[model samples]
Target chain A: MKNILIYLRLGLRNLLLYPMRTGLTVIGLGIGIAALTFLSAMNDGWLQNMKLNFVLTQMGHVQIHAQGFEQSRRISDYMGDTTLVDEALQSMQSMQGGIQAWSHRIRVSGLASAAGANASVLVSGIEPEREKDVSRLHTFMQQGTWLQPGDKRGVVLGDVLADRLSVGLGDKVVLMAASPDGDIASEVFRVRGLIHSGVMDVDNLLALIPLKMAQHWLHLGAGVTDVVIRTNSFAVVDSVVSNLQQRLSGKPLEILRWQEIDPMAEQWTMFAEIYTWVVLLVVIIVVLAEVLNTMLMSMHDRVREFGLMAALGTTQQQLFAMVVYETLVLVFIGGILGFLLGGAVSLYYGEYGLDLSQYATAFSFMYMSSVVYPELTFNGCARILVAAMLGAVLAGLYPAWKASRLNPAQAMREI
Target chain B: MSDHVLLEAGGLCKYYHSGGSDVAALDQVDFQLEKGAFTVLSGRSGSGKTTLLNMVGLLDTPDMGSLHIAGENVLALSLSERANFRLQRIGFVFQAYNLIRVLSARENIAYVLQLRGMKKTERLAIADHWLFEVGLDGLGNRRPDQLSGGQQQRVAVARALASKPALVLADEPTANLDSVHGESLMSLMRDLNDRCGMTFLIASHDPVAMAAAQQCVYMQDGRIVSVATP
Candidate 1:
């Protein structure tokens, strides 16, 4: 241990002999690590935004539907009795950190016509007060107000759908759908609001109406197509789904978490995670190249010095260790500098958010917000630093080996 | 090998290839050094005095030789074993005053002791004593580049002796210095030889070094031609 410390001290002194070279190499590695850290934070922010937008705008953390209702979407497949679902939800509400909010929804495909123009739509029958607690759909109102309870003849249309129908707030539109009794039922509803959700499907095809009115029109007495539940966090969604499954066992209902509801979202998240690592790997390779270049140059410059050390009784292993220690010192300094620079920048951006408003249209299409808040966790910082050090060790090895292989007598004769 | 004989070499032969032909650098040389003796190998350039020093210092191996230092057959040791042997029993002073430029005068001397597993305080104290003994009492903190050429050589000599090795090999120790520094350095080596009984085999053709030697061996064409008491 004492001998190792002496070698380390010698290594440090040797590095100090070439300040310019050492400083530039350190800065090069620092920049690479900083880029890795910053990009990782940005990727984290983007993925978080995508996930939040997915759950808040439409899909809640967990959902329950009648067996086969999701695939069939037929009015006849609606849950005829709400007793089991209500009992399960009431039991869940009493559990610690359980469901935050839940709402029953009746969704059906229909056609709307106004001013002699018609467009296809997915009409959602919702209880306005309960839905506001479960989803952010009410916050997307662009004109007029969201649906209110007891507004039996009122309806809300997506902005694009209203445009297709040539209707606006206060205009009457006729909704037509096949009832569970095999009759084509139709009704006239005044447009109460227009929603601009930035999602193509939502903006082009959604129609919201009071649940009581939809139940009467569709002849589904006390029946709902699906129930959406919002939990405090996504982390609890799977456990909540499992609990609901157990509570509603053998009741002809399918309980699913959000990922099961939209597998594409989960896949996208996984791809983002993998992409971040690939980018970090590329950065590490770049850092490894820089470290290799610097150490080789140092070795070339100090050939005679290495020869002298060898002649002075330094072992081959000690020579190799000396070079490694020098490289490690440089890497340690660079890693800390990079962490500070990247962490500070990420913290600043995280607090204020990075404004990507120019790409708002593209971001909205991908179900993300324009303003993204970067997050730098302890684990993220640690992973990047460890990668940099590992790269340094790998880079240092070849040069250290070369130095250790020096022929002392021949090397001493070098001019 | 005898108890008084610190180094012995028989039939030492070294060859170098140049232009596809081998030239003998050390051809069938026989040598011995007694304990506490100050000896000099005097020769012209390319007469293989430096080559002999390199062999004795364990920096290079002879093509054919039975070499023993302090009763150990050094030529038979592995690369690692040779290094350990050198560290424990041999020391060297080069003509170029090849002190580690990054280390202080004291550090250069203490480095060997540190390699021997001595504690910092103990090694540094020994370094200071060697510095004083080498006439560098107040210059222990100066780096080689900060010191004069002669002072740097003094530091190198101190470094070689600080480990108290059984044999010290010097290659043209006076080649890079002027007469004044050369005489002073030779005088210091002789004084240390008498005072501490440290065995030294210095390779040099310098007159001052030859004058200070207790015994001198003359080499020509890689063979020792004569041995005389100076």
Candidate 2:
């Protein structure tokens, strides 16, 4: 170990001799690492935001969607009895460390209009008291208040939709939907609240109403889309789902997690994987190329020197170790610099977040809801460092092997 | 002295295959050197002097040869064993004075000693002693680039001697130095030969080196023409 350290020091000293070249090569590696870290952080942030908006906002930690409801979105997916929901809620409440809150969601599509504007909206009818504890929609409201029990004609308008219709506070809106009899029934609703979630799709199209009122208006009583359960922790979603399935066996009910409910979460995860691989490949190529070029040049310049070492009782193994030591030195110094630069950028963006306010309209589709915050996990950082070192070691191989295989007599005789 | 042959070679031949034809670099040759003898091999370029030195030093394996160094047959040893034998029994000085450019004169001398697994204190003491022996007492801290050609050559000589090996093979050790420094280095090698009983084999084409050796072997083409005892 000590001899290796000595040789490593010698290698480092030799690298320091060419300051400009060393600095440039390190900067190149730094740029590559920066690309990887920055993109990784952005991908993580997007997934987290999606989980917050689409999944956790209403579905809770786990959801028990009746089979085929996720694909078809029809009322036929509702299974068992409505009384079973009460028993399940009671069972969840009585269990120790199992679940925190539970609620049933009913989704309906209708045309909502003011005096001059009409747009299609997705109406979610939820239990007031249970939904508050389950999904925390109370924090999302910007104006008015939540629906009360037994309220038959109350509705909440998303902030963007309310803004487009020039209605707020106590403005009345018309909700028109087709009844089960295939007849269109229209009802005038008093806007009870305004919800301003920065997500453009949700804010422009989603509305929350009382469950009983939704049932009465759509002529489908006791019809729910799915049952969402909130657990104390999200990490145990799969375990809870498994236990729920085992307990509710022989009943055709299928429990779905967030990743199951929203196929986009899985897509986001695959995107993160592809993005990380691309960054790794590009960075490895650039770093390895620079290091290989430098090492080959340095070795070729010291042909006669290597010959002398070979002649002076230094074995081929020791000579190869010397070359490896040199490459490791380059990697160590360059990786440190790259890590510092990349980490500085990541931390800075992670803390302050990147503001896309100017291009907010342009990013409406990609859902730049708020500021873009960079996210970093411990695992991602470790992977970057290990990858950098591995690239460095591999870059040293070709040159070191060549130097070790050279004939001492012929090498010394070369001009 | 007859009972202890420091070096021996029998039927040593090295063939070089270049392009399409085979050129014999060294024909079948037999030679020996007694302990503490200063032996010199002299020839023009491509005359096999350096090839003979390399084969004897175990830097290159010879085809069709039986070689013995300090009573051990070299042909029967493994690669690592041969390396170990070279580390323990041989020291080498080159024409370019191949001291590691990043290291100081003292560190260069102590390098092989460290390879020999000597302790730091002992290596240092021996390194300083040999630096002083080669008339570079306080200059041990200077790198090779910081010194002149003669000083670098002296540092190289000090490094080779610091290991206390049984044989020191020098390939034109004074090739880059002036006549005065060359004569002084030759005298230093001779004095070490007398005091420490370390065998010396030097390969050079210089007239000064031919006159300085106790036995001079002259080569022509790829074979030895004559061996003169002076």
- What fraction of the correct interface contacts does each predicted structure contain? 0.69, 0.41
TM-score of 2: 0.89
Task: Give the CA lDDT, 0 to 100, for residue A42 in model 1.
Answer: 83
Tens-digit lDDT track of model 2 for A242-314? 7777667777667788778767666766776887777666666766887999889888878887877776667
For residues B1-230, could you state the per-residue lDDT of candidate 1 as single tens digits? 99999999999999999899999999999999999999999988999998888888889999998899889899989887888888888888898938988899999999888888888899999999999999999999999999988999999889988998888888888889999999999999889888888899999999999999989999999999999998
Cα lDDT tens digits, model 2, B1-230, are 25578988988899999999988899987888888889999989899998899898888888788898888898788766777787898988888847888889998999889888889899999999998999999998998989999888888888888888999999998888899989999989889888888999999988788778999998877788899987
Give one digit per residue, the lDDT tens place, for model 1 in A1-415: 4477877778788878999988898788788777788888888888887888888887888888899887787988898888888777877887764789899999999999998999999999998999999988999999999998779989989999999999999999999998887788899999999998877767899999999999999999999998988998988888888888877888888887877777778887898889878866866796688889989988888888888888988899999989988888878888887888888899999999999988877766667788889889887787787778778788889999999999889888877
Task: In model 1, state the lDDT of residue A25.
Answer: 82
**DockQ measured for candidate 2:** 0.52
Model 2: runs farther than 4 Å from truth?
A: A79-100, A109-120, A136-150, A158-201, A218-223, A246-250, A358-368, B1-3, B15-23, B71-82
Superposed model 1: Cα runs more than 4 Å off? A67-78, A108-120, A174-188, A215-220, A245-253
What DockQ does model 1 achieve?
Answer: 0.69
